[model samples]
Target: MDIVLASKRRRFVWSVAAAITAVAAGDVLFYQRGAYGGQTGFALAALLLLAIACRPAIWRDRRAWVAAAAAFAFALQMVRDPGPLPWTLYWVAAGMTVLLPATGTFDDGWRWFQRLLAHALRSVVAPVLDLVRWRRVRRARSQWRFNLSDGLRGVALPIIGSGVILLLFVAANPVLAQWVDRLAGPGLWELDAVRIMIWIVLLVAAWSLLHPRPIQPIMGTFDGSGELPLPGVTVASVRRSLIAFNLLFAVQNGLDIAYLSGSVPMPAGITLADYAHRGAYPLIATALLAALFVLVTLRPGSHTAAIPAIRRLVGLWIGQNLILVASSMLRTIDYVEAYSLTGLRLAALAWMALVGCGLVFILWRLRGGRSASWLINANLAAAGLVVSSFALTDSAAFVASWNARHAADVGGRGAALDLCYLRMLGDSSLPALIELEQRPDIAPALRDRVRYVRNAVLFTLDRRMHDGGWTWHGERRLAAARAEFPDLPARLPMPAGDRMCDGRLKPPPAPPAPESSPLTVAARP
Candidate 1:
């Protein structure tokens, strides 16, 4: 009995402590408020504590109740304007997970509830948001010229593109939409499933009407069993595959542009042609030109003609990949707009990696000897290195942009450091950056630049905390700077000047020095 009581007491204490920490941390991080934030904040903390306390009992048999509570929380949060709780449902569910040792607490019933909710939310939310935003946009831009081709292109391109990509996606993995619906919330799940299914059906119908031919396969296109099969899937096939993939990708890629381009600020010195050519256009063109010879050689009984055709097409493909790599590296170094660089690099890298992998696989198949195995291993290692390099390079720019000039708090040093770490983690090779702080691998100039920004962030954070609250003018400047240079790292520094104070700028108070003279005496008495 004593053991049981002690265990219960320990659990309660831990629960309360965790709850307090969560409340305090959340207030500091997100709301810029403190834990003493009135009834709502306290109520949330109480819920967290209750969750922790009942966790073990919940394991004994509170599965249905937990699910019901979670569902109720989710529903309340959705309806309330001020919001009922901060991720109340998630916290409750997570707490229940800790409590429950048994499997299948939700059972199939929980899944059903989830699906139902997801469908409803998507059905309701998306249309409402779209309608409201659309109305606002229409009112704002009343007299804009409607270019017929542009309008048609905008409409047809996204619809067709979404259709094709979704069909391929669904065909590749039928259960994906259903799974997504389950995870995202019932409303989203239902909406997405319906949207995707409708798109798939439309794409299938449209594709049939268009009667698009299969652009020759890049690999496994030639019948290996056939007499005199064209030299093991000629370069033409590879080019054709590349083109088909690019065209398919472009259609899917334009969805965001179709829907959200209106919200985007017009970039300076960027024309329509420039924007269009910047993304998947070059990829599609590269693939198409490289595969030109394959199309010419597709005629039956004219197989011998493919030799010269393959050579020319392969040369073009290699040339295109090389140019893309060079251009991408230049763009990375020069800081040309990320939108242009990222999409281009993504397609180029994926293509090159795929082709390189295929070649290695083919070599392994043909030469089953030890040397062939070693060669394949080398190719795989090179591929991995390339991928890692690309990730690190991409993340360097990402980390750099998080610099800010606010207080050394949520908006300050901590935030910048977190962003840097996030970017570093995204690349495999940059693990040492977290520990070393200054690696020889990072160029001396780049390291200096990063260190300067990091130090500035630390300084800002310290300085801001010294001041009572983040002042309006300072926050505004930080926001404006962030807007102007989205790619640069934020450089919020710790506060240091005389301005940092309580009544006169000081670090926030310690926990009452663990005792007050009167309170301690009274409690003791």
Candidate 2:
């Protein structure tokens, strides 16, 4: 009975400590005054929240410790990149890490999915359960009088002690001081609907981790075998489909090799860019459909997969699909060369690559006679890896830098520098804009235009740095820009309308039509 009471006391103490840490850290790291945020603050808050939320597993299980560390590192990657991709990767990695003990293993994608749903359910249910537990505790302790003064008296030691320890730690580590400075940068008292929403979300996410349950996954990994009761798909149907698909894909590949080769003349009125760009995304969709058909019809252990001839046909079809994917990638690249790359185009390129990888995994699964679980896990792992890789690199900054370098303004032969688009990219384009503004090759008139855009971006970044949603990378860039160009404006330019931000007075002139000649084409790359 004494032991049970001690255990309850420990649980209550830990819960209080974790809750206090979460609230204080969240306010310091995640509170945004205005519209923009979720870069640096999110990176820090995610890790801190993971620690506090997963504290139970973290202390008891080695696997949990490893998962927490991995999540922390993954989330920390956003410090450098800080875009939508990183944000997604961080949440996925963090969520899975928090739920790892409950799921038992990471090998089954279906089980993880089941656990994800449970995680959401727990986010809503756990807090109510906690309140019930607290009520019971309060009833048990009712004999001892408690009030607001008693609560203040109880917390004083912890508050003063923690402050002293934190000061010493900061003194020992200069980096901690930097973190504190950044955390203290935003307003401390701001509150609104959005911030309240953020608070609710943070609380729910944290509490879900704190009160985890070992859920028996309801959905098991499905192996797409003949015995699974799939209907209407037969060996004969798959064989015929493969034959027709092979023939159709062959025709498409043939046209790509001939017309896209630049060695052979394209049809009248169809230019290289038109042919290349037109089929870029559509071909990817076609490949996806072909991949789905192969997965659904020629599933491993199915009669369609047993025959060597059909397997060969499937292999041939998959190879053709890969070629189609490659052609689509080439087409997108060619379009990028002719036009320019944007964040969306870059993501499209990544998506195409992911499609190609998925097709390869599908073919591998069939060849190995692997289960549906294997195929699903392999594809998901491939996708997660691709997203993680992209997350580690700042795609927006890369796009901005690439566009600026290749823009026709500095004589790189690509599209003219679109100041409007650059402005839309926000502070990610600030460094590139700064570089373009200082380039010796820029025309005097173009230099003035670049200066205006650069100033506008600089001003906005300053507001973010002071207000909220700023990154360490952004801070470094701002510092470097100040050192390089003292004349860079921190105030909004007096010029309004077209010259305000990106300064688009009129639409940019349409680019000239592409030549039909293969020699001028960049399709090969």
Candidate 3:
């Protein structure tokens, strides 16, 4: 019993130590430096810190290794483009982060994710409880104990030595220096409440990662199959619905094919742009509803699923829905080409593709007799994959550049340039606007408008840098723009009132001339 007590006490001490170490590592990677501050090298370094502090046996677990790989993927994506999607996936995959000590035993990803969430909620008060437990552990007498001398020599000395070594390494290595900007966030004596609060948050997050545990409420299962649950969804009714859904979808696809190929003339009032624009989003909605209908009616374990005839019909319907999704995406593309690409349109394209992937997964589930959990996981994984790809892309910059190339003002034959819209896109649009302003073919009037809007954007960006505190991506973009700018003007006052970045499709009417008076006599040019 004494040995067992000693073992428990020792483990608790290690857990506490590990939590502290994790917190320190988090401070290095995240803290106040901003998202992806350390980038890839620092991210890996932070992971290494967690590995050393976490239980040694976790290293032997395949799940733990898989979790580490996921961490790397998320961190790299953050490095590529720091945004909410990568951050969401980072925490989503973090369910298995280092095979968290108190995540309890789990066989699958879904359970791990559920446990992580349960544990995280409980961990809100974990710090206070852990402190209370520490008091109890301190009073309990044990034969095997860690004394002050032992702690000083064994723990503190090593930490002090390692910190020194780390500092030296950081000085010698640029990557390390970039990753470990120790004490560089705020001044050593600075009292920033926000930064301090961020530190506390990081500590809680790290500690929770190490010692997560809570009642993992009974997870709901996807075994919700059977005719009993979905009333009136009989095999015969399902057959009729599948055939009808397929026919309706076919009609949509057929019309799309005609418009897409220019093989048929419009019936009447619909212009190609209007036809493309109107159908893009609504068709996507139709596909989603069709998917939900399939899930509810065609349970793999149901009587309908047992029949090969029903399966073929359902398969045919899903195939048509996939085609419909493709048509929707093409419609969005056609609309964009006719008008101009915007951030929202780019997102619409990605969202449509994700919907198509969901339809495919639903069909696969029916064919394979996969469980509800399996289907959900497959769709989630697809979404995560798409989101990560998006995180790596610069949608705003892409839209700006695409519009710049295709705008008829500069020589291309697409849509007329809308500098107002480009200005609305913010700093990311600066380079593209600079390109337009420099073009000789660009109208003199348009060039002057671009210069005015461009100068205002530069002023805002420059002011942000001057305001200080480790601005990175923004600063780099501003520098690049400055290098490209022709005879860069001094920082200008930002536009006030409703300028619309100097008007929409066409320039606004020139302000009315003031009446000439003795004191307001017109001056000769």
Q: Give the 10-residue window scoring lowest on summed lDDT in candidate 2.
A: 32-41
Q: For this target, which candidate reaches the highest TM-score against the unseen true structure?
A: 2
**TM-score of the candidate numbered 3?**
0.76
Worst 10 residues of 3 by lDDT: 32-41
| Candidate 1 stretches greater than 4 Å from native | 1-277, 280-379, 388-525
- What TM-score, over all chains together, does every model reach? 0.23, 0.79, 0.76
RMSD of each: 28.5, 12.2, 8.7
Enumerate clash totals for all models, in the order shown.
53, 1, 0
Q: What's the TM for model 2?
A: 0.79
- Give the candidate order by descending TM-score: 2, 3, 1
Give the clash count for model 1. Answer: 53
Per-residue accuracy of model 1 over 1-525 as CA lDDT, tens digit each:
657645644554454344444444443332333111122333343443445344554436666355535534543332221122334443334333332333442323233334334333343344344336545644565463443346568899789998789767856785976664455433432334545544343323222111111121123222221123455555456456646644554453444244224455546886433444354345444544433333333322334333454434444444444444333333332232322223344445455454444443432332232232343344555654454344323333333332222113223422223333323322211222222244345445445444443434434533443343343233443454455446645444443443222112345666655554664445554
Compute the lDDT of residue 155 as modeled in candidate 3.
86
**Residue by residue across 1-525, what tens digits does model 3's lDDT show?**
878776666666677776676555555445544433325334543644464355565666766667667766766655544557666666655646544534555544466566667776767778878878766665565444664446668888789999899878977998777655564543333547765775677667666655544455467655647665566788788898888888888898999999887999877988888998898888998998998898888877888888999899988988998888999898888888887888888988989989988899988889998887787778778877777677656678789999999877777766988877877777778878777788888778788778777877777777655543223456677778867854665564665544566542345779999988767668899
